[model samples]
Target: MIFDGKDLSHRALADRLPSDETHVFRECDLTEADLWGAPLAGARFESCVLDGADFRKADLDGAAFTGGGGMRIRFNDADLIDASFTDVDLSSAHFGGALLTDASFTGCRMIGAVLTGSRGTGFTLSRSNLTLANLGGCSLRGLTIEGVRFDDADLSGCDFTEATLSDCRLRGTRLLDTKFTQADLRGADLGEPDDAKLRAFAGAVITQAQAAAILAARGITVL
Candidate 1:
């Protein structure tokens, strides 16, 4: 089923959807729409306004979300395996208890998004703004993360073993119990990491400039 340019705001659309067929929604205003437990597997949502839209417990595996999006959309406990989100504004979106394995998020504004307690092997995040987002206890092992910003975000207990971060920013990011064993952080801007934060990157590889900066911060002059 295809719904184009439809205003589905504040409507209960779970019962109206067909489970046997995949749906496509383009340029639709789905703000505050209730789709809890809806069977939306492999659905495509393009340029849709999803502000406050509730997709809790929805089956959204392999779903594709592109272009338009709004703040505070609820996706808690949703099944998002292999889902792709590109150029979407998903700021403050909830993903607690959601399964996000193999999900890819690119060029998205994910500020203050709560990804803690999300159950999955892992997900791919690139070229995205994740400032102030909470990704506690998440495992990003062996992933190549590029052009992402994690400024002021909480990364407590995250596992980045052998992960490569390029052109990334971790300014003021919380690294409590975070592991970076054998990770490559040569291209990341790890702004003034204190003793605890520096210890978090013990086994990680960094550039000479970063080392110089770290030493310079402690009043050490490097030749």
Candidate 2:
């Protein structure tokens, strides 16, 4: 079923949707729409305004969300395996208890998003702004992260083992108990890591400039 250029705001369409067909919503306004437990597997949402949309417990496996979005959208407990979100505004969205296995988010504005407690082996994020986001306990192992900003975000218990970070920013990020074992952070801007944050990066590879900056911060001059 295709819903193109439709205004479906503040409506409950979960029960009315046919479960046998693939759903496609393009250029639609779904603000505050209730889609809880909706069977939306392989669904395509293109340039849709999804502000405050509730998709809790929805089956969104292999779903593709492109272009438009808004703040505080709820996706808790949703099945998002193999899902992809590109160039979307997902600010302050909630993904607690969501299954995001193999999901990909690129060029998205995810500031203040809550991805903590999300159950998945891994997910991909690139060219995204995750400032002030809570990603505690998330595993980004062995992935190549590029152009992402994690400023002031909580990364407690995150696993970045063998991951490669390029052109990323980690300014003022909380890295308590985060693992970076064998990770390459040569191109990342790790702003003035303190003792704890520095300890979290143990076994990670860094560039000489980063090492110099770290030493310089401690009042030690590198000749």
Task: Give TM per candidate.
Answer: 0.99, 0.99
- Which is the leading candidate under lDDT? 2
lDDT of 1 by residue, 162-211 (tens): 99999999999999999999999998999877997899999999989999
Residue-pair clashes per candidate, as listed? Answer: 0, 0
- Please list the Cα RMSD from the true structure of every candidate, rounded to 1 decimal place: 0.7, 0.6
Model 2 earns a TM-score of 0.99
Residue 30 of candidate 1: its Cα lDDT?
A: 99
Candidate 2: tens digits of C-alpha lDDT, residues 1-223: 9999999999999997899999999999999999999999999999999999999999999999999999999999999999999999999999999999999999999999999999989999999999999999999999999999999999999999999999999999999999999999999999877998899999999998899999999999999
lDDT over C-alpha atoms for residue 8 of model 2: 98
Candidate 1 colliding pairs: none
